[model samples]
Target: MLKSMRENVKSLKWVLWLVVAAFVVSIFFIWGASGKLTGDDAGNTLAVIGRKKISGDDYLQALRNRIEAIKSQYQEIDRAFIEQLNLPQQVLEQLVEQTLLVEQARAMRLRASDEELRDRITSIPGLQQNGKFVGYEMYKRVLQYNHINLSEFEHSLRQDIVLDKMIRLLTAGLAVTPDEVWSDYQKASDSAGIDLLILETSKVSLDEAPSAAEVQAFFEARKGAYLIPEKREGLAVFLKAEDLKKEIELSEKDIENYYQANLSRFTNPESVRVGRIWLPFEGKDKALVEAEGRRVLERLGAGGDFAALARELSKDAKASGGGDYGFYDWQSLPQPERDEIHRLTSGQTSDLIAEADGLAVIRVTEKTAATTTPLAGASAQIRSILLDEKARQLADTRIAKIEKEAKSARSLETALRKAGLKGESTGLLKNGEAWSDNDPSGAVGTALFGLKEKEVSAPVYTYTGVGLVELRKVEAPRPAAFEEVKADVETALVNERKMETSRARLAALGRRLEEKNWEDIAARNGFEFKTVEAHKRDQYIAIVGESKTADDLAFTLPLNEASAPFDFETGTAVLRVRDRKTVTREEFENVKETQTAQILNQKKNMFLQAYLAKLKQEKGIQIKYDKFLQLTQDVLSRYESAKQ
Candidate 1:
């Protein structure tokens, strides 16, 4: 259909014009279209790429689309994971790069054809049903479900295609040399054998413990390192929601209201318990795989037990357990597999279904229909949820009232009594220190550090409950008296002496390597002389720990030449190369293609990085770091609010 449409230039021109008209009409509804953002609207701008402003709303929508894509692959995602990704920063950079590419493409008079855009949209599998395009309705529904506007998605798609074309045009001529390929193959396949002497810190022992006077002198000389941590002492008045629950009373009307509002949460999707017999391709003849699949199906059809056949013939990891794949909803499986499963009833088996690498035979052992819990059934859960909400609200209100009264109160005790709560004093605590197990969330600790002596803190939510805090005293970090930390100082001094002694002994042993055999010296010192045979680069040596230095020394040093003591986290190592091997012609030939591909990929990545750097410099990219950070914080705050 798209080919025919592309062939007719007149129709294509009309379609392009219609798309342009629709884009122009939709600009009013879009959050920050060019020339439309001003005043309060202009504040929403996240970044500016030349004349184009990427708005906060646009960035957030893009982020949501990305999150939805990830959620499809992973069931449970959390705020910490999202924050770790630095998604807001990444999204902003992507938008800037995209805008740069689009500008360059337009400068080169490049445009995506109407037919090309149409083909791209229809080609997306999500917009198809029963192996055919489900038309515009299904496309609209997909966009709606993902919180994307149709116009915005189409615009983004066109931009992506244009940018991809630009990238291909720029990177078309990259190639790898034969010499580079051979070097990569040699690096990957070459192995080395070595004899190693291992000396560990734990092996070093002191003859005697340091005296109390010596320990005191050592601490006195390094008093700065022994200064006490700064601490704060304060009083906390807690307002627990569980305590507030005693005062909260829910009515039948409230329970019914909650049930009606959150009915979706009470509904369960249809699911299936399935067993599969898989015959993986494994470079075997495709005919053999298909025949095996058919044979399994025939056995099942002839009343042969599915589990017994699966255990005997299937290649899947679950084959050992009768190929039981456990429970799955429609969305849990790939569309092709899901469609095949949907065609089977409980106790019925599927025909051979071809996959990317294998053929699978599925038996729907059991099926469960979708269900919605009745009002009575859901009432108990709804009541619990409502009660928790009310309790939190009541706690917040009480804490707020307590905070107001505490500002003028002479003591936290008076304030607590007024608020109908108990107050406890937290003995001197370092910043970030918890008081017993009371403030496991560290809310009190965080509050206390920011408060001046005798100052009351505003209400802050904590893991245990809501609370108002008052800082009673501030303790500055100071050097401890000699007697106060004598035991710690003794321990430190002893360890330092042991390390010095070990270094002296290792240095003597390293010098003697030229005079005596390494094995004889190791035996004299009761150390193990271990040999690692035929290990490649990037492989770890067991006795020397996972030291790359030891591996490199083995490869670099000549035969029988011992290295100087190489100090690592664990201890020191003396490595001597025993033997070295080079890649043979036959070995190189076997891995030639794979090694060439790896080298080419590495070169391509480097080239792409350099090209992008040049483009960014040419475009005179500028970013306001403060504004970016502020926007990121705002986004995270909104996400946290939504989760709550």
Candidate 2:
């Protein structure tokens, strides 16, 4: 369609008016648009859309209700997402948007009943797992973790349902035909296939500098192109996660399969009791200490307190507390360390054991032999274990054949085909870290990083049970070859030069603008005062009469102050600072009318919230958020813990 439209436009060059008409009709009229406004606290609903009202009472209630809802839904603590709510602007906009959307849903006769509501709520993806609604406990906790009230969330959810239904109704049959699909495919796949010879300044001599007249004309034509963009100068500490958090959305089947596959992790590893004591390698007469420890064990065998003996004589940091080594099962400890500890049982203390730093005395305090851990007993761990198995399964499926075939194959080029595979080759891939070149599961990442050149692992598993993958080839890090990126280097140099020249122009122009030299600068630089009439805040449009740089600089100019030099993407334009005015009532009406619709939506939101609350109150809804949170932790923790 775009290609056809472009072609049509080209063909109708004589009828350019049609293009303008098409834009105006399709974009502004039919689709409709809203402006995000900076507004005053008018203590009013801009407008009510449907039945939901934003009465003064409703507005105040809405604010209080939103706050309480937030308190109910999430941990009252700081997190990145949570911090976003703290922003003054964000909070205000968010509340307003919510009110509008919810009330709008109500106005259209869009609604769900108690049973209908319950059914819809259960189906929400936010609270589903393994193709089933998460337990009531998990559901509540998930809401809390997200820092939202259950009522508010359902209110939000109901609004979404209503909106979704509206969208479906609106967009029904609003689709691209096969012609459209083919059109897209053609434009996307069509090759411009440009191969042109170029001559540059490097090819030209210094004597070939533009003639004075030509230079002036060129400068005049492109003067507005160079300008600085508006900039935010506040200090910002950008949040960058050291490790990408896993974002695994699992299917019910995958979860179930995963649960079935990793049953062992779900069970607590038959709780084993162990105590540890350490002797420093530098301890004087270590052999004597060992002998003494043995004698102490002998005393314990003769009914002495082992913990007391450990505290009195053992040379371990933990000995400070009478060797009351904390309780833990073997699985909780590091594997190599746990393996040694696992051999000991209740009443049996190890002899002077040498591990790393020093000799250690140890005793087993308690033990629980292998027991069948019930589903209820380890649901959290089971969920995670299941998910990991699923990721690994998926990863293995992806790479298993490649891994096996690569061993016997001569080259990756041949093996990839024989295994029916494509290695997602890219230099941008971080070593040992995930790149979204493949499934985004990090399974491919691990396989790629784990391999040593040709070394291959069988269908390797991933943190998510996406499936398995096999390592194929590893590319060693190397600087880019000049031949490979000569064009890129040239482009970079050109861009750099352009930026420098543009900034100089802006700086010079800014001086002229400051001195009321608009006419002189316009004539001298071949520019003019660009006017952008009736543009609302945050509206994206070309500034009429002014260059982009000048417009940007103008926006930055303090009230009654001249703008300094600025640079835009195209070029520099030092804008003469002009008057800034508050948007008129007409502008506010445009916004107010829209906000009124939102107020209507807020009414619906409130109604739904009240509706759900009543249902909970009447039906006696019960939930344990902690249990649910624990379940989420169990399912999600695999991505992090399994790798370790």
Candidate 3:
């Protein structure tokens, strides 16, 4: 189970991507504590960080919140799948980091006052009605309806305020020096061309055959890799939500009640949806910026694609979305831009509008009038929503009953019989194997592999609905005999030899690279000799694909100097710097200010991450292993006492 859990957590590459993507977004999701840990809470603590104690209950809530967030990205995610992904631990790590950041803020004497917290909460778009806070009672009701505890949410929000303050305090003064700007400019503008000697690993052949002893030795060295994965056989009872939905019958009263109770959801304000192409005039000449904006507007007038042009030239972050600014409330927008959008009809383009920062051309895509959805018009949608809600409620009630019975009886089949549900037999399935398409969330696989023989699992939710599993048998992986895997061993040996031979040949070629002509050496050795045209730092190489090592060598290696053998996926290769280009001082000066600010922001982010990593290392996180194990089992429904 641990091995499977580890497999599902994202790799380091994904973590790095998240570091950039969530740098700002992360502040919102970090649920924090009140900094008042009592002895009672400490008894149930999952982890300790200095004076901070993360209780089991807090951890559970954090895990639940994290699961809901994950569900937004993966609609089919359920309890079993969450367990498989080791999300409980992931959430714990996040909480620990939040604690650390909060602690640092307090140490720095940063405080989020009650007024600030109140302002922040009232300012939230969800908690507002017509741009006004929906009073105290309505606020509590809204939070309750969403299953958010008011106190916990407030505390978490307060911590977020503190963290934001600290981040601003730390990064506000950071700026790139003149030398740093020049260095970044060089990296962006410089290009390099390389002469290559390539040896394809697949084409390499081994004339000599390995002895029996060598093959045996290779197999022995990698015995664990050769073992078959563990498998499990189980019985399960699944209830599809769609099937339950078919049985639900919504009355007219139900639709009316839902409409009345959730009137805010049915209200629509007057709004305009516009696509904008903004040209900023911060660093560039204002005349040039306006000229470029006019050219783009002229292209639009001549039937050019708005979205395509936006993607190609717009400077806004939403440029990737084809410059879509989305719908904005009629009153929220400012100035002549709003007036310009209001004047244009749907699908009509606006004339170039001047703003404080830049020139923008707006295209009005849609205009909506203020209105409330009447019950007669919303009946079909309300009925569907009520049907889904009631179906889920019924499903949860039934699953809870089944879980109760299974726990008391210790037999999933008997519990199914009591519930008048048929038990389906799952044939032996290896770890990580999906039983069927119905289990797209991998809930069945997660339940089956985590259970012991004759042990019944808690209610496992799947893409379709919910289910319970009973493990009947477990097949532990075992080592294969030498003769049984002889052919596999020989294949492995041959591949290893191919790599070794390619590396050896490349090493030999590297020695003569400076003495002989590159093409002559390549021709004599039957390797390909080619020159990759000059490309920027981020561009992909022709034969080598995209590689940081290759990029570094290309930019750093002196002209006519040969590089050491660099091993890429397809083969090994040596490169000689053939040509280079450097940007002129005039060109660098053109974008110096913009490049400096961009590089400074990137550097600050890197420094922040490195600082946090070092802080975490120095103040080591201590876990209460027994409590953590209990928490994991409790969350996954592994313990008999875990179910509601």
Candidate 4:
């Protein structure tokens, strides 16, 4: 369909326009077309996506924005985890894709109309209050606070709208057939039971231990494997948040100021846990719905079970769970319900209330009045906060001075002595070794390793507080002594032999599997034989664990036919399908429509992705690898510097 649409562009233009009209009413957010195309700066261009160039600054800003977004999700996000995300590559890919999409929209003359743009902006939940736009002034102020240019933001948002329009236009022709849906449903629902023999590698033993000659030969062959990394020695002084508490002093005025500044921290809003039995007015007599609401209220008033009645009679989605809406902050409950709830005490039922769609009888199972801790009551916590804040400030000042002194004196010991502070000796530590768990990203080691012998480092943030490190000594990497690595070499040799023996044993068992009873064969070979209950093909098999190989063999192998040995990280396994379960005709029919919709959506995504790839190829996307690497290093370095 995509190929046909591309080949007959003029004929399908009207059809695509009609599809675009149909889509505008449903999708809230959409991609926009290109704005202000600029020539690429050779030195700064990160990538060229067709005519539009993504500059280094643009990539950095986008990367920072993405990091900020991720920070909100992970409270304790660290550099190691961020690096693992490989976000530089991902962000660049996204920018290139977005640019391609915007260009495509421009070519097709697909644009977001002024009215649609206005609707999209106003409908942004952050820019609205109580389901109405907060007006242009407040919206502008909010954007200003976040350092966003109003025009730039809108253009970016418009680009998103146009990009989405182009994608939807392309994918609109894709379809999923009823037969395809049924096939997908059956594939996902099919299950199998299997007898598995897992030969534990750890339990496998070598027939005999390797001789000293063998160990020596292995060590000689891989001497670099036992090479010790360069080590550093240093005297380090640590400052902790708690250590500076003695120097902190707070006045009553200080506590009061803090209490006012952080008022929300001390305030607890009033809330109610409400349970409701709703009788909808739709497709039923209004009077009958009102009568049902009254009956439910009466039952609750007479000390009857509210949850039981709600489960039996309520038409709401929460009916199965006893119609509990959990807790709602006082200001969040809608008008009539809020007023009625406030009047009722805990355990009291509300009178039949008329709602737009239904009559509801709500019960207040619990209520908590709003509270703000008095200044006097919060004084202790306030003092603690003030002390921590002041201590950190003091630590920063002292560390800054120490860093200067250490740099000038060229000795951490001299600097500490002059400052009347004692330092602890960090006995020689190897490069890449974790000196402190709080410094998991190994910033301290990186700083120290980059220094010459006897050189002191700038202040390093250690999560707990701030400190400085000095490279007192440097040990060059060297091959390990025979005695020093004897135990390690022996262990490695034994483990390797065990693995080799396990493979051979499994192979022997595989050769005899068809001729012998599985249990008897496994027991004779010192392997464990087990059977897992029937489970879907995708489901985790506790006995077999998580092996795609095992799963495939269990389902594909004929019943009573044994499988050959399959290797796993921890063990080796042979499997036999004992029983098989397939999706029933009734089961397939029950979810046929839902399965069809899911398959359609999946097909649409696949088509869109392939279309984008083709477009990208045609546009001749080019990335400057050296510049990309420099940008990645800059991002990581900035992050590290910020930690310091």
Candidate 1, residues 397-455: lDDT per residue as tens digits?
77767777777775677878876778888888878777666567676888799888888
Query: Which tens-of-lDDT digit does each residue in 180-298 have in candidate 2?
Result: 44433332222211111111222222323344455444445554443332211110011111111243455566655555676654443455556666556574676776676568657
* Top of the candidates by TM-score: 4
| Model 3 per-residue lDDT tens digits across residues 76-130 | 4445677678887787777777778878998999988999998877776544445
**Among all windows of ten consecutive residues in candidate 4, which has the lowest summed lDDT?**
24-33
Which candidate has the top score in lDDT? 3
Pairs of residues clashing in candidate 1: none
What TM-score, to 2 decimals, does candidate 2 have?
0.24
**Each prediction's TM-score against the native?**
0.53, 0.24, 0.48, 0.58
lDDT of 2: 0.44
Candidate 3 stretches greater than 4 Å from native? 1-158, 161-224, 250-388, 425-432, 448-453, 481-567, 570-576, 579-644
lDDT of model 2 at residue 293? Answer: 58
lDDT, residue 245, candidate 2? 21
Candidate 1 segments exceeding 4 Å error: 1-208, 246-268, 273-300, 303-340, 351-362, 365-388, 406-417, 420-423, 451-455, 497-644
Model 1: residue 491 alpha-carbon error in angstroms: 2.9
Of 2 and 3, the candidate ahead on TM-score is 3
Query: How does model 3 fare in lDDT?
Result: 0.73
C-alpha local distance difference test of each model:
0.69, 0.44, 0.73, 0.71
What TM-score does prediction 1 earn?
0.53
lDDT of 4 at 299: 79
